[model samples]
Target: MADVATTVAPLVRRLLGGALPVRLEAWDGSHAGPDVPRGAEALIDDAAAETGHLTIVVRSPDALRRMLFAPGELGMARAYVAGDIDIDGDIFALLDLRHRLGAAGDHVRVGPSLTDIGAVVGILRRLGALGRPLPAPEEEQRRRGRRHSRRRDASAVRHHYDVGNDFYDLVLGPALTYSCAYWGDGVDDLETAQRAKHELVCRKLGLAEGMRVLDVGCGWGSFVIHAARHHGVDAVGITLSPEQADGARARVAEAGLEDRVEIRLQDYRDVTDPPFDAVASVGMFEHVGAAEADTYAAAMAALLVPGGRLLNHAISRPDPHADAGIHARSFIGRYVFPDSALHEVGQVVSALQGAGLEVRDLESLREHYARTLRAWVANLQGDWARAQRLVGPGRARTWRLYMAGSAVAFEAHRISVHQVLAVRPHADGTSAFPATREWLARPLVADGTGGAVGG
Candidate 1:
């Protein structure tokens, strides 16, 4: 068998033949270059080079073959997920390298570039006939049946969320809120930012004492617990994940608000309870695919009473026509959020309007989401070893990469998170919302303890 050094040396040569912006280090202690044709020299990752910023570590020759065979982002992601390739520092900066790879598509008009073809041949020759190496079964998501079917959706949610609550606690901080947080000048911590986010949703919905609120896709009862405790409302939180439902019910009981909060392991389509005074769905909207946007809006509207408000907080795509083939098949879909879809904000508004809901207000919290993801990444990195022990390295890699890549995407405006406040208007066509958006400006009050969320 050829040694790791000889196998990676030629592969590194081919990578450098392009204008990659990082320095590559092989298992045998060989270095590539800081002499990138484009991008900052400081972004290069060389341990001995003082100017290096990022370093790509090639752990094995098979890892190199994985990239060479697949090519492009998916190939790179597979290597990362398989633990064959590792990025040592500033994984966010690796986005720059991805952009370069995307732009290099111009070089392959008809087929693979000469350098790419050569690298594949060289890596394969060294690695031998390793026929179609599959990612660790635990790493890849296997969903059956039609896309977005109820059973399949539940499976997808379970695959991602049923990784154990202890694992999520490490990544999501104390609040256990698995969504974008609302960060402000006063919000300095993850728990605090999450509190601000829940409170913001409550305030936007005009949640009040004795009101009935329904929280769709509620994870661990964060919003439902918050709403029932803080706003003195009867809140029902529903999720498809059995693990989440179990955790949420435990949390509701722990908060001693079991009477006011009901955590149901049910799907939104089957939720028969109607005439909720207010409704909130956070981080759940993205899971409702584009084809089902209208169905989702109509369902929520059917459960809401006239004059009741609904706040839909979800991620949105800037370009509706953008090809998300990479997202659908990459680590995100394979491990993180299988079959999830992000629709344009305008499409969301149209769907809501078509469902007889009035669009009251729309606000972009893109920057806040970026900040939230950065905090999650920090939490994950801080408890890196523990997280790996809890969910294993492959799953941990999924969260770290997904979070960092999403943060950079948010920062670049390639994607965004929006809080769309809408209301089921009365027969007289009145929304009953405050005349101005001033109501949302009020300072949110929380004990900062991550204690029983709401009041």
Candidate 2:
């Protein structure tokens, strides 16, 4: 029986090779890799040192075996998710190292190279007696049945949104609005910004007193309550998550607007009524898979009366060729938003037009979403202990990593959020929209107090 440290030392040696730019420390009190870059002396903590120093603590030898068996991103992800490996230094730098090692020509491919395969084989051959491969964490989702089907969509939505409303409350502020907020007009507070966002959507859709509005994928009834209480519209909100529907109904009742607001656990496709004067779908379009985008647009178009307005607010991937489904092997699909899909803005516009709706206005809220995510990250970090207790450590870590990464992506313009306003034209070929965008600039205050109306 050999000690674990002795078993892994040779593997680490072969893994780093001779010309090492990084330092690797093992949990067994053994060190490998060059003390410094191939040619330079070790500075206290220079940028190079920052990028090069990585502290890896292996909880179990099985972790290394699993990593070596699979290799590349999926293997690496499994090790982290299973709590077998921990990286103490910069995670992004480690990602960069992986990119550098896997680059081909001018492009960086996420797949492993032949060198990577050879290295894994060598590691396994030397330390094959350690342990057998372990199954991935129970958290990884593998939904069965047809994709985007009504029942399947409900399961997917519940998997993500039904993770305890208390957990969501800690992440989202008092308003509990999960979508990107409107941060314009010097609105610096989260609650205020969220209200401003709902107000902006109402103004864009031209909601008025007695006008009927349908809020698709309405989370917690934030927008529905806001529209009914603030915009004087008779609003109905629908969601696939039963928890959200319950919370939203309670919220509407609490707002004392039960006569004007209705929240249901219903699917967009199941919506049979079509007399709504205006419709708003915020943060919901992403759930409509690319394959279902046409159906979604057509459904919304049919729901609206002639000359009615529709506002589709959703996040979009800037890369034209990015997959609409969750990124390959990403944590978002495994733990966060299972079965979610994101479409490009152009694709969204085309779908709307194909559904017989004429595009009237388009606004990008990319930076606002970045700011909103940063706030959510701060809130989660602030209540880290409670979050872990609510959702367990693995799920909490998933949220932190994904939220921080999404904020960076939004700031870098790798992705964006857009509000696409289109209207069902009258027979006269007029959209009935104001000739100018001036109507949106007016401050329409339906309530004197600026606090959040309902849950």
Candidate 3:
């Protein structure tokens, strides 16, 4: 009976079809998996390692104990968050392992073979991993109250956003825009791509001088200030996080755009002012649960005047059937976005149409989000000490895992994002729209410093 890497290696290899794509280093100073040549050996042993491709480290017996009790993602997530285990290499490799396991099919999930279970249990017993389930990390959150109720929604928002402005500033870059960026041709770097994204949104909404705009779930007033200062629009940005509202207001004041922009700590449902020229909900629609889709669509509709545009930019499930029976209640649901939900792009369009907003455009930015997330992960890892200092180790680990995992997920197309441009047509069934999309791609200064004049 050994708790060494050899014991753990065989089990994982058996589960993943007898060959581990990743190296495993167990708590007992033993290692297993592929024999790498020379320096490539470290290529993937560090989860945050840029050159690393595949390494999973069981730092303690508790890592296995946690997994033994919980199984699947949750247990693994807890082990990672608690520092019981560490990863080296590309997270995508883990996904690949799952793909291999899927070939094992029903045996893996529906009902694992009894012999297989017995083997795992026997190994765990030998490794001293069979025990009471460890407590979940304190960082894990499960929201209370009615789902999407204004109060509960606010809690969920704060849980994700209250992580501090400085920390977000570091991860999100100077743009401070937390959404899928436009990685258009020759557009490199996070800040530039993010500005391109905002500019693209402004154009899609047809923003111009004297127009009134609303930014729902505005993170920190970047969009509203951009709209008002550059596009000359009177903009109102609303958010559920008090910290975010304060940060946005402070930013607006700093920009001397106080007269043109307002940051309200309010939910979209509580907004009373209407007849705006356009509305923008970027990266925030996930919190609007599927059950509240109509309410969300109607609210956006109610906020726009006739002929005004609404750009609902959100991460969406690739298809309604794609996520069927798959649960979001895994690690992300319990930790990062407690009550979030993703709907299919078509379903989103249907909801908007149900509220009388004509769905105009749906462009997938799936790859762009992957790029954005990769940049963010790099930023966090680059300044990891600072990040850990700002948010503590557990939260820092959470963000690193969340952002990197998201980047890979986006690349895999397991999830997607879209910029949905819709319009509130006039009573006569008329709405203003350009005949071509050529104007939307006018190249701007990649750094967001000078140029890229807004209309």
**Candidate that scores best on lDDT:** 3
Ranking by TM-score: 3, 1, 2
By summed lDDT, which 10 consecutive residues of candidate 1 come out lowest?
Answer: 103-112
Model 2 per-residue lDDT tens digits across residues 1-455: 34444445444434433223355455556544445333322211233454755655666656666665655545555666677776665544543443334422111123233356665555456655445677877667777789899998999899888888999999998989999987766567888788888888888888888999999999999998888876688999999999999989988999898999988899999998778999999999988886899999999999999999999999987766777777535556666676778888988999999999999999999999989988998898899899989988777766776676677667667678999999999888887789999977665332447432211
TM-score between candidate 2 and the true structure: 0.84
Model 2 misplacement above 4 A = 1-25, 30-45, 48-58, 69-71, 87-115, 124-130, 443-455
Residue lDDT tens for model 3, 54-157: 77898987877776666666676788889998877665456434454542111112112334566667777786668777889998987888878989999989
TM-score of every model versus the real structure:
0.88, 0.84, 0.90
Q: Which ten residues in a row have the lowest lDDT in candidate 3?
A: 103-112
Worst 10 residues of 2 by lDDT: 103-112
**If both were scored by lDDT, which would come out higher, candidate 2 or candidate 3?**
3
TM-score for candidate 3, please give it: 0.90
* Model 1 C-alpha lDDT versus the unseen true structure: 0.77
